[model samples]
Target: MAAVRTNGERTVNRLAIVSVLIITMIFLAPIYWIASTAFKPRNLATTIPPTIVFTPEISPFVKLFTKRSQLRAPPSQEEYEAAPWWERLVFDGGEKVVRSGRGEVQLSGYPSRFMNSLIVAITSTVLAVGMGTFTAYGFSRFKVKGEDDLLFFILSTRMLPPVVVAIPMFLMYRAVGLNDTHLGLIILYTAFNLSFAVWLMKGFIDEIPKEYEEAALVDGYTRMQAFFKIVLPEAATGIAATAVFCFITAWNEYAFALIMTNRRAQTAPPFIPSQVGSGLPDWTVIASGTLLFLLPVAIFTFLLRNHLLRGMSFGAIRK
Candidate 1:
């Protein structure tokens, strides 16, 4: 009977593992397609039956980063040989890199848009998470009048669909001369993410023992000092987890970014799709841009993966 039970448990474990693998592949298939398409030659990108195995080239990435025009004529052997490898890739595609009157290479707008995304996402995440941490700590450690009502009010801001306020927010931004500006998006994203940050952080802070702070207070630490020295360290996992979510939300935000900013403050999410011009769109270039855009979030999450795992299970077990 014990042997039968053991065998049953083993079978259950195997089934669970198989289920996880299937789900993981389902989630990863699109990412795999994007990564694969990004490296494919231009002609192969749109093949009816997708090319599973092929020689990978960096030309799509080169095209993704540079401005190019259809070649009027093939480069002479002299021009091709003298051209750098990256330029040759462009030439081989029957396109020439756009250059200034002084022959300086002109770059695509993607890099700047990517930078804008980083600036806004990073800045907003820091502000939202920082302010939320302080607010959460207060709510967790102290008694307040109408605390439940206030917390509900905070959380309610996120209850409505963001699109409901889009036009009103756009008008407000325009009236304030905040349209098409990095600061504008940063402020909006911070406000959007702050409530979520506070609620999530409060749970993590609640799990920390108040006695630790009391001990610090007895050691002559001011409340602020105790917070920074004691509470913050204890809540590091929560902070990391909250920051990751906030960053991703701000990074991938679309509608607000689309309506709010144009030339100067556009982000990768909006800019990547706009690469599809009136002509036959370069799928390879679009795929390459998407693949690159995914890296910052992927890297950020990977770096915080340990904390995120801990944060998820932080308060699950009780003493």
Candidate 2:
């Protein structure tokens, strides 16, 4: 009986390992493909049997720089046709060139879109995290009538589909002369992120002992002082996690961003797809831009991974 049970346990452990390996590979496949494509030459990028490994090429980087100059010069129809395939691939008049295998690559849209995304994400995160921290503190400390119900209602707002409110928001923004503006997008992202921040922070704040704040108060620290000096320090892990979540959501947000902003303030998400024109999308450029776009999120997550794990493991351990 004992031998049979041991064999069964070993079999279960083997199955678990196999399951994890399969799931990990499934999740990593897209990232591997993107990284592979980013370094591949344009001709090899779309090749059959899918080029998994190749020598790094700098031609894509070179073309990215030169394509804009070529685009500005009006090519005669005959001259355009006579131009090298790479040049023709890169420049398509006013249409956005998604990818180019020719002369030098143009990168105007990517840089601008990246900057816009950074501005929106950073501003929104700061506003959401700052405001949510204070609001969460209030909810954690005060026992107002219907406070639980109020908290539930606040969380419910996040559950409502963003698309449902998008039209109303668009109309409201237009009425206030805020449409297609940086402030408009920032405000929208902040509001959306605020609900999650408040809820997550409130839970973290609640986990902190009240005695710490009481002791600080008895020692002459004001309520605000106690909060900043005691409670906030203890909750740093949760706050870091919340801030990362807020920033990522704001950074990757697309539907609202697409509907809200045009050429001047568009972000990386919408910008990438919109660049594809009458021909093949610029695979190399897109791959390069995607790799760049994902870099910050990857760094942020990696840096705060421990804090994120602790935050999510809330209430699982006593001490």
Q: How high is the CA lDDT of each candidate model?
A: 0.88, 0.79
lDDT of 1 by residue, 116-212 (tens): 9999999999999999999999899899899999998888886667787678889998899999999999998999889888888888899889999
What lDDT is reached at residue 223 by model 1?
Answer: 91
- Per-residue error for 312 in candidate 1, Å, reads 9.1
Q: Which consecutive 10 residues in model 1 have the weakest lDDT in total?
A: 310-319
Q: Candidate 1, TM-score vs. the true structure?
A: 0.91
TM-score of each: 0.91, 0.81
Best by TM-score: 1
Over 4 Å off in model 1, which ranges? 1-20, 304-319
lDDT of 2 by residue, 1-319 (tens): 2443677798987898999999999998998787677766787888888887799765454354343442555567896787666566454433223346673445666677889999999999999999999999999899778997987787777777778878999999989988888899999999988888888888789899999999999999999999999999998877888898889889999999989998788899988777676687768767877877888988988887766654344323323
